[model samples]
Target: VINTQRAELEALRKKESKYKKAQEKVSTNKLLKDEIEHLETELKTFEDKDVEIGSLKLQTEKLSRANKALMNDIKNEQKRYDFLESKYKELLVKYNIAAKDLEKKQ
Candidate 1:
């Protein structure tokens, strides 16, 4: 009877050890699943940020093009202003010479 009891105790101990190993495996699996979920969330966030970056880059390109066009317009306006100024100076000189001639004659 004692020998039979010892055998049963050993068998229970084996079963307990197996149960502990199974619990450890379950815990490790839960941790791995949580890690995978976290990584997936991070990946989604990165994808969203990438899309936002693309949109910002497109806006930047459009703004850059508009700025270049405005710069060109400014340059053209400056040239027109310089030409008008030159013409005004020439006309002033002509008017001054004509007035001096008229004064001399009178």
Candidate 2:
């Protein structure tokens, strides 16, 4: 009877040890799951920011193209003004020469 009681006590101790190990593993698994969830959330936030940055870059590129077109228009207008100014000077010189000839004839 004494040997039987000792055997039963040893078996119970072994079961208790296994249960403690299982509890520790469960808690460790829970901690790992929590960390994974946090990392996933952070990754999603970064992805959203990346998308926003891409949109801003596209807008910047569009603005840059528009500015280049405006600069070209300004350059064309300046060239046109220069051409008109030269023509006006040439006409004035011709008019002055004609005025002098008429005075001499008179």
Candidate 3:
């Protein structure tokens, strides 16, 4: 009877050990699942930031093009003003010469 009791005790200890191992495996699986969820959230955030950065880059390119067009217009206007100024000087000299000639005749 004592031998039988020892055998039964040993079997119970083996079953308990198996249960403990299964519990550890479950705990490890939970940790891995939590890590995967965290990584997925991080990836989504990075994707959103990338989209926002792309939009800003596009806006910057458009502004640069508009600035170039404005510079070209300013240059054209400066050339037009220079041409008008030269014509005004030529007219003033002609008028002065005509006035001097008229006084001499009188």
Best by lDDT: 1
Instruction: Evaluate candidate 2 by giving its C-alpha RMSD to the native, one decimal.
Output: 3.0
Where is model 2 poorest over a 10-residue stretch in terms of lDDT? Answer: 20-29
- The local lDDT score (0 to 100) that residue 66 gets in candidate 1 is 100
TM-score of candidate 3 relative to the true fold: 0.69
* Local accuracy of candidate 2 as per-residue lDDT tens digits, 1-106: 9999999999999999999999999999999999999999999999999999999999999999999999999999999999999999999999999999999999
lDDT of 3 at 103: 94
For 48-95, candidate 1 gives per-residue lDDT tens digits of 999999999999999999999999999999999999999999999999
Question: Which regions of candidate 3 deviate over 4 angstroms?
Answer: 1-4, 95-106
- Give each model's whole-structure lDDT: 1.00, 0.98, 0.94
Measured against the true structure, the TM-scores of the candidates, in listed sequence, are: 0.73, 0.69, 0.69
- Model 3: per-residue Cα lDDT over 1-106, one tens digit each: 9999999999999999999999999999999999999999999999999999999999999999999999999999999999999999999999999999999999
Superposed by TM-score, candidate 1 places the C-alpha of residue 31 at a distance from the truth, in angstroms, of 1.6
Clashing pairs in 2: none
Relative to the true structure, candidate 2 reaches a TM of: 0.69
